[model samples]
Target: MEMEKAREALMVEEEASELVSRLDVRPHRAGRDASFYEGFALRGIRVDHIQPGLLTCSFKVPPRLTDSSGNLSPGAIANLVDEVGSAALHADGHHMKVSVDMSISYMSTAKVEDELEIISRVLGHKGGYSGTYVLLSNKTTGQIVAEGRHSLFGKLKSKI
Candidate 1:
């Protein structure tokens, strides 16, 4: 039974990867660099607006991301928090950073096919550590689904 489940999971992952490849909606970065958060593209998350110290993204909750109870899973919410939060670091001229800690508060649940807006902002930076805050909100109904805080520590890469 476990082996069967693993095989099924692998098959689902392959299918999602194929769909991502066909979508042609990945974020465009110079030199065609592979984003560290490639799974975001696979899951149909798109950067709606980005600027220094802030990033706004939109996503549709796909059925595959839901728990058996038909609501978005905690893991999926956490993934969004982390990915969106990391993107905010770029606003501070950081090319990369390693997560040091993270926390999330789940305020509400999102159902499959629901549209969500994720807003992330750089809160502070000191001594090679940066803090970010992210909020997930329902686009249509304007309800907050989750909020997250992330701390990261790493060297900020030089732009030039």
Candidate 2:
């Protein structure tokens, strides 16, 4: 019994080491370098259209972003809402703002390999503050996957 317990403890420690190694994200190497989490969540996203105050994109639910059950993870959903919603404000000009608040409602799930449509629209803007609405839906079934309201604030400067 003692030998078996020791073997189990060794296996658990090894598993933990492996998991930590996999989770170590590389630090940004340059000014334009995106953090690992950002790149991981945004990878393979394709912009379908963009105009002032409006942005639309298509994305396939990548397996890496999925949860244990193979459905798109909730954290990934929030990242999509935040990034895509921010772009709606940036579309009018290249103004980048810091997200002050975010509210998301997860209405449904998208599994790995499922196609999702993401749309964002600017609600309006005040001096140094703005709000955006983002809707993510299933591309083929037309089911709403999530809805998000993102609020941001910052000094607006035109930067390419």
Candidate 3:
């Protein structure tokens, strides 16, 4: 059931367009069944561009994504790393990818309502493993809030 839900949530272009149309008519609320990226979008993450092995994303930090002290949560940052990194690979021709290992290093903190710019790239791929990197920075100040590295296993769409 969970696998079915996940498969449904990872919509293709046409299904994604339909989902957007529905969202225009009503708010999206998938509750506990939403895919990770779906939940991230609900929290305001927006992808701006994709090219080859790179992607650019941004989001205005909402209060809902902050911790009790009113700073962006590490978990939220990590989530961005996972999604954006996979997106980079997808842009680079991978049809499916799963994280094998991810490491994040937080350098600073972002406050609620901060607009963050995230840049993610695929370092390279060898065999089934790919190395990816992500950097999150304050859009206005250019201060890096966090950086993350991810190792993933995936197959090219053609190969798949």
Candidate 4:
């Protein structure tokens, strides 16, 4: 009986894998509603400064973004880096760029209520490709929490 059950489970798993393998990706549509992740990551974030090719922001580490042990979650930090780093590229006038590569270095942990200073600066741009660097540091303790480099690419809109 146990062997029969195991065989049935294996078949089910194989079928699931086959279904997933058949799926294909499509380009994102513009009118879709904003995702839950957007709301979760945007809360409590304030733009402290902005200029051509640069962005600086402030955020208080909220409990909702913390791990079980009370430190800020790494995924949340990565999301912040992605968003802010992309925002820094807006000076180039390409509003629809997609991240093609990202590298992040985590240096320290931040706790709930810790104010974090986020700075993003453009590294360079060529045609539709761009690069940027981001830094996240604790405001009070002045400790760097993470640093990231992001590369993005997008097609320019044709003017009719």
Counting clashing residue pairs in each candidate, in order, gives 0, 0, 0, 0
lDDT of 3 by residue, 1-160 (tens): 9999999888588866786676433354676466645755445778899899999999899886798899999998898899889889989988687899999999999999999999999999899899899999999999999999999986555542
Off by over 4 Å in 1: 1-42, 157-160
Best by lDDT: 2
How far residue 124's Cα lies from its native spot in candidate 4, in Å, is 0.8
After superposing candidate 4 on the true structure, give the runs of residues whose Cα lies further than 4 Å from its correct spot: 1-35, 158-160
Each candidate's TM vs. the true structure?
A: 0.73, 0.82, 0.73, 0.76
Residues 31-139, candidate 1, lDDT per residue (tens digit)? 6765645644345998999999999999999887898899999999988888889988886578688889999999999999999999999999998899999999999
Task: Work out how many backbone clashes candidate 2 has.
Answer: 0
Which has the higher lDDT value, candidate number 1 or candidate number 2? 2
Alpha-carbon deviation at 30 in model 1, angstroms = 15
lDDT score for candidate 2 against the true structure? 0.91
Candidate 2, after superposition: displacement of residue 97 in Å? 0.8
The C-alpha RMSD of each candidate to the native structure, in angstroms, is 5.8, 6.0, 11.0, 7.8
After superposing candidate 3 on the true structure, give the runs of residues whose Cα lies further than 4 Å from its correct spot: 1-37, 40-42, 155-160
Off by over 4 Å in 2: 1-17, 31-34, 157-160
Q: Give the winner by lDDT: 2 or 3.
A: 2
